[model samples]
Target chain A: MLEPVMFTGGVYKHDLVMELVEDLGGYVLQKNVTQSEVILLLLVPKEDMEALKAIISDLRGELVRAPLAGTEVAVVTPTLAIHHLPHTACDIAEYLRRNGAKSNMIGLARGVGRETAQINEYESMLIDEHDAVVFIFGNFVECIRKKEFLYRNINIPVVVTGGPEIPKEELPYAFEYVPSVGRITHRAKKATELGTLDKIIESVGRALDRTRTDISKDPLTTSPPRVMDAVREQVPEVEYSFSPLPIALNLNGVRIKLPYDKHKDAVRAVKFDEGVTLGEVATIRPSKMKDYILVRILPMSETGFVF
Target chain B: MDPMEVFKVEIAGEEFGAKKYREIIMDILQDLGLIRSIGRLYVYVDVKKPVFAVYGLLRTGIPPLLVRDVADVAQAQGGFQIKVNDEEHMSDLLKVLWAKYGRERVEQPSRDVVVVATDTSPSDLPVADLEAEFRQDLTDALLRIAPEGFRNRRNEMTDKSFFFIAAEDTLKSELISEVKEKIRSMENA
Candidate 1:
């Protein structure tokens, strides 16, 4: 088993931590350097965790378990207008990012009003790409109940947030409902408000765990991290892409941040040491998010083998 | 404790919505610094009917800002030299001076000093109409306080009070009268 962990420390000797993970046959998922400080997201072998901890302690770096790592989450709001943004939506997205998840904030084009709100096909497709989604609603129970149609068609688990205390059965389509985080005009600073944010994070963590449990029943041919590492090494064009994380990981596969038309062949041509190409094990297609490429790895039932 | 003398919100069949709207109104009003200006506020939102209305009573007697209030006027070498005590109204003061005595006659020697060519003391000139500005900001705060889905809006302002209504559908005369009656009843209650 591989344990997901985050390391935070100064820039000096951060490479030693990466070296240690590499030596332990672990993968460094992401490395973020902000001025003199650095943040490393890694997957370390479970038995070798104590050795990595010893190295981190000697280097004086902080290491914490990141449960939401290697997954993508969507924070959906009614609209991108000032009424729903810069406060509630932004805080939720930022909190998810701090928990080691790649969160995308999606504002519905015409998702306003009690009766006139809507979600189009394109929007649904984009949100379906993530592992889980959190839909932020307003205070009214009638409005919350009425907005169920928005996420009913989504395949991923939907976590609904609002102001009032509504029963879970009220929203049958929602995987979970978190209350007390409705519309707000100010940043969440008070202890109670911060606690509400923590509740949201916990709910999202549980939602992701449920998905992870399902994925475990039928594992993929290869893990997403291994695919990410191979793609990064073989596909040199991904380095020139402006995206902070050129290759974003999900439980099923990794999203390569490059144009689909031009780089689909290169992404499919990525080879593994087991004499198999990526195209044989995964489906490479155009992503709903911009012109990027999305690769969904096939399960072992179809491939007849596991890496 | 509530800041307004009388604050009430009524949403038909939605107790949670009413309470949340009350907090939202107060938060938006306080954020815009218009809480003190409102003596009473009655908000009536009918989500089923899909209309929102706000009736507010404003505190009376906000005196306008004049030159004597913001600066010290005195006799000087060329003309009347006004030394501004409050730089907040410096730009307004300069504009007033230039309008009274052409651009050539008004000279700002320093950031706080303004000289007028005329011999008459420019002490009592009105630099800014603070009451009008306050009313405008209060209107903006009211619009923001209403829900985002309500696109059609109508605002009525008097010397001492303001009535604002917003609705998703077309706002009709009957709907306005119904909302006004609801707010009036809330005020009495």
Candidate 2:
């Protein structure tokens, strides 16, 4: 079993932690450097966790278990307007990031008003790519209930967040409902407000966990991180993309931040040590998000093998 | 404790909406720094009809800013030299001076010093109409306070009060009268 963890410490000697993870046959998912500090997201072997912890202690670093690591979550709002952004949506997105999930904030084009709100096909498809999605709604129960069409078509687990506490039966399509995180004009600072943010993180964790359990029943031919690593090595041009993270990971696949038409062949041509090409095991297609390529690995039932 | 003398919000059939809108209104008004200017406020929102209305009784008497209020006027060698104490009103003061006297008659020697060529003291000149600025800000706050989907809006501002209504559908005369009647009923209740 692989354990997902995050390491936070100074830039000085942070490479040692990376080297230790590499030596332990673990994958370094992400590395972020902010001024003189560094944060590393890793998946370490469960047995060797103690050894890594010892080294982390010696380096005066902090380590925490990140449950939502390797999963991509979408923090969706009605629109990018001031009424829905920079406070509630941003806070939820940042909180998900802190828990080690790669969160993308999506604002619908015509998603506003109680009766006139809508979610188009492209937006729904983009949100469906993530492992889980959190739909941020407003204070009114009527509006919250009326906006079900936005997430009803989504296949992944939908976590709905709003101001009031409504019965779960009211939103039968939602995976979970988190309250007290409605629209806000200011940053979340007070204890009650911060507590609400924590609840959102916990709800997201649960939603991702449910998806992980379902994926476990019929595992994919290969893990997404392994595919991400192989694609990064073989498709070196992906690094030139201006996106902060060229290759974003999900539970079952990776999103290659390159134009689909030009790079689809290169992404499919990525080969593993078993001499099997990625094209044979996964479907490479154009992503709804921009012109990027989305790779979804096939399950073992279809591939007749597991890597 | 609430800052305003009377604050009330009514949402038909939505107790939760009523409570949450109160907080949202307070937060938006406080953010714009218009809480102190409102003596009483009544908000009524009907999700079914999907209309939002706010009636506010403004605090009377916001004196306009004058040159003597923002600066010290003194007799100088060439003319009257005014040393600006509040730099925020400097542009307005300069415009007022240039309108009373020509541009050539006004000389800004330094960042905070303005010299007028005329012998008459320009101390009593009105630099800015603060009440107008407040009214503009209040209108902006009302627009923001309304739900984002309310495209049709109408605002009526008087000397000591204001009424604002917004809705998603086209705002008609009948709808405006209905909203005004609802707000008036809330004020009475």
> Which candidate achieves the best lDDT against the true structure?
2
DockQ for model 1? Answer: 0.66
Query: Cα deviation of A54 in candidate 1 (Å)?
Result: 1.6
Model 2, span A100-140: residue lDDT tens: 99999999999999889999898999999999999999999
List model 2 lDDT by residue over B46-132, tens digit each. 998899999999997999988999999999987999999989989899989989999998999899999999888888888999999
- Residue B185 displacement (Å), model 2: 2.0
Model 1: per-residue lDDT, tens digit, A1-307? 9999999999999999999998998999888999999999999999999999998899899999988888899999998988898899999999888888899999999899988899999999999999999999998888899989999999999999999999999899999999998888889999998899889889999998888888778879999999998999999999999998899998888899999999999999999999899999999989999999999999988898898
Give model 1's TM-score for chain A to 2 decimal places. Answer: 0.98
As for candidate 1, its clashing pairs are none
Tell me the deviation in Å of residue B43 in model 2: 0.7
Q: Which ten residues in a row have the lowest lDDT in candidate 1 chain B?
A: B139-148
Displacement of the residue A273 alpha carbon in candidate 2, Å: 0.7
Runs off by more than 4 Å, candidate 1: none
